[model samples]
Target: MGMTTDPFSLLGLEPTAALDPAVVRQVFQERAAAVHPDHGADAADRAERTALFASLNEAQRCLSSTPQRLRVLLQVRYPELAASHAGAVMDGAFMELFGAVGAALEKAKAVQSRRAGVVSALARAMLMADETMAADAVMGALGAVNDAMGALERALPALDETMRSGEACGPQLKAAAARAGFLEKWQAQLRAAHAGAVG
Candidate 1:
């Protein structure tokens, strides 16, 4: 999609982070259908139709996720926010938690690799036992990640209020975006552990 059209505009919604998923999905489906090249557009217009359809799909995907929606909203509303906070350092306490999560993820990843490499039933059982032994640490890491995510979620209402009031919110939005990034990455790591255990 062109930088000229932000995700909200592409999806025909007001530019806000707290969008209703149902509304976004409905708008996305409508827009997707309208721009789809298969809908009897002239053959010569296929390129334009394809681009529009792709843009609509991209917009829908971005706005459908909370982190992505916030990031895009910040990008559209405060272009400088991303540049200023792209590398904002997490506070000491958060960093400690993040480090712990990282260590646990590494352990989980190693276990998953070992599990994948072993073909013998006995070896698989042993790996499962090892994973079971490490369950507490993995769970603790997941708990920390969830707590951090909760903190991020609590900050959203204040950010939204600041936006609604037409106040300067570049710092708040940027911080939120950064925290969202951290949470998303941590959650993915935790998901890998869960997937390994289930598989």
Candidate 2:
């Protein structure tokens, strides 16, 4: 769970800097086979197997991709990575890249919330609010998420400075962490909506 430890190591694999998704999958499958509940007939091995299976799943899922892996690693080991990257003051090139990404995320949130709010409001209107008003509320929540993400982004430079300069307690980092929490929830809702649409 901590970034200091390689997730691959948890699965009994060397924590290599280079990625091999196939190898990771192979290790996970092997580990899970040894510990899965299907092997629980043997009481002595059941608990251990279950624990190993769970850990295998976590390691596989978390390390399967760069963003998820990075996010997981940062949230665990380098949470300071979030704040410093979000609010730090930097040269034009870095700032431009950060700003562009922030803008894209905001745009995505706006579009998703607009579409989701329409459906959510239609479903919730009987709760006393009109359809239009309900939709607006949903969109408003999306905007709030976007704003929080933006603030989180803004704090990256400051977070980096604080972490790099060895400033232990960073207000910018705290704010960015809070914003990341909000963003996670918002992103989840969006994902659920997307899944529902797909289904």
Candidate 3:
């Protein structure tokens, strides 16, 4: 199998969004060991094993993340539906969460800006209170984002059950993938902001 091979098939997993990341990692490790280039007998065999190992690495990377796994599963199972839902709008709850994260990030930026403008140690010390407040806000916002991500992860089992039951859940899978993508992005942003606020 090459890079374009189905990731679930490459990783020996059933195509479902409810996969546990730890299980995927374990499976990938086992498969990678079997195909490892170090076990190759000759030059040509080493090259072939190297390629296969690379493909396995790609598969593991895609399947180890909830968003990427969902996208891969959707594209493999419902290409047309996945393409159609590419630009689907996030629902109201995500919008609200996005707003909160945005606000926290802005506050952190403001604190960073003020801290940078202060050249004197006394001035910088004076700004510590505001920085602490900003840090607290960022931590709170990060907690909210984490909670939202957890909720999405908790819903994956039900989505898997729906698919297993032979119902059409491409739309739901697409929506969850979209939300996971946003949450992952926001989580990174919030983490960076928190670091800046505290640092």
Worst 10 residues of 1 by lDDT: 81-90
* Model 3 Cα lDDT, one tens digit per residue, 49-157: 9999999998988888888988998888788997783575788888898888888999999999998889999998999998998999888989998999899999999
By summed lDDT, which 10 consecutive residues of candidate 2 come out lowest? 190-199
Better of 2 and 3 by lDDT: 3
C-alpha TM-score for every candidate: 0.82, 0.43, 0.95
TM-score of structure candidate 2: 0.43
Superposition TM-score, candidate 1 onto the true structure: 0.82
Instruction: Report lDDT (Cα) of residue 62, candidate 3.
Output: 86
lDDT of 2 by residue, 105-131 (tens): 454445445456555654544432333
- Which residue runs of candidate 1 sit more than 4 Å off their true CA positions? 1-3, 113-124, 197-199
lDDT of 2: 0.54
Error of 3 at 40 (Å): 1.0
Show where candidate 3 strays beyond 4 Å. Answer: none
Q: Judged by lDDT, which candidate is best?
A: 3
